[model samples]
Target: MRPPDFEARMRAGECFHDVRMLPAAWAVLRLDGHGFTRFTGRRYEKPFDAAFHDQMIAAAGRLLERFQGLYAYTESDEISILLPRGWDLFDRELEKAASLSASLAGSVFSIACGEPVQFDSRVWLGARDEDVVDYFRWRQADATRCALNGWSYWTLRKAGRNAAEATAALHGKPVGFKHDLLRAHGIYFNDLPLWQRRGTGLYWERFAKEGFDPIRGVAVSTIRRRLKVDRELPMKREYGLLVGRLMDGAGSGDSRRTA
Candidate 1:
């Protein structure tokens, strides 16, 4: 129904703001729950909930499988997925990449939890492998800080303090003060589960599989890779070491080509 000139004008206007990620850089998509505090508070337990954790894991697994991600890290209500430098999904369009990641995460989580949920996504580009490692390390540190604060705040709330009171109590308090506050109530932040503090990371690991080849009439061994989920992540420098090793392996695999 439109004239030829109209179609041309529409295309020109629409493509003006289209932005793509740099082709040589790796991409990381970080998705965070939208208004999940109220959403989960009414449906699950406080501070930490096993059911919520399970749902997040299920959704993360689905994303990793669907996107062919190199790695995924989740903590609290946030997930970070690492995409290889050569990935060209949606032609690496920034808007498409962010929207699709958020949509996939929200849909998967909602389906798994049987409740409507939403997530917002942002893309981070890294020019070097070390940048990726540092990004995750930064996120892991944030997870640790959030875990401490959550435990401390919820402990006060459970003891009859309202939200305002809990917030006021934690206001301007140093990390040591928060630790002491939790310790006074018989809770040790360090004693919490590693996943609760350091968050969970998922990556692929290669393993050998033994199988029988009927046509060849012989037993065969194949090297196959599968996702490895690590809940008990190491802390600080050790965690950085782990991330570095994973990045190194991925880089090596990316560089190798079979003719």
Candidate 2:
């Protein structure tokens, strides 16, 4: 409908903003909910909600299946997805990867919750395996801290304090103080559910299934794989080791598929 040079002019103007991740580097896409504080306040329970947790796991599964991600970890309203070093989706374009990841996750969660929601995403580049391990470890630590704070804040609010008063009660308080505050209310932070403290992990696991082949008239076996959702995640070095094993297993599967 326009002149012949119209398309060329538009392309030239937008081309400079195209940026890509470095080749051969691992990519971790972290998606965080936008305005979820107000959104979830009326629709879900505080501290932890089982229905919301299930929705998050379902959304994580969708991301893993759609993006070929190696793993996905979710805590609260944020999800972090791991991609292999060799992945080249969307030619590693930064804008494309970030936008699509956010949109996909947001759509899945919104549909499951029966409400409109939005998520924003950012990519983390890991130059080596250790970097990837550290990235997850850091996020897990954040989850623990947030879990503690959330329980404490809500406990004070339920007792009689308003939102601002409850927040001020925790400001500048050390971790131990927060724990003691909950202890005073008869809640042991360590005794809470594992998923509440450590976040949830989703990945693929393989198994062998035996079947009878009618055409061949014999018993046969084949490998099968499916998505696994882990709510009771470990801590510290143990979690790093678990993630390392998952990465190794994914690499082995890739090799077999190519061969």
Alpha-carbon lDDT, every model: 0.84, 0.88
Model 2 agreement with the true structure over 1-259: per-residue lDDT tens digits:
4776898787888873578998999899999999988888888889789888888888888887788889999999999999878888899899888899999999999899888899999999989899989999999999999999999999999999999999999999999999999999999999999999999999888766677778867776766777888999999999999889877765225211210
Q: How close is candidate 1 to the true structure, as a TM-score?
A: 0.92
Query: Tens-digit lDDT track for model 1 on 151-176?
Result: 99999999999999999999989999
Which ranges in model 1 have alpha carbons more than 4 Å from their true place? Answer: 15-17, 250-259
Q: TM-scores of the models, in the given order?
A: 0.92, 0.93
Error of 2 at 195 (Å): 0.5
Error of 2 at 68 (Å): 0.3
- CA lDDT, candidate 2, residue 200: 98
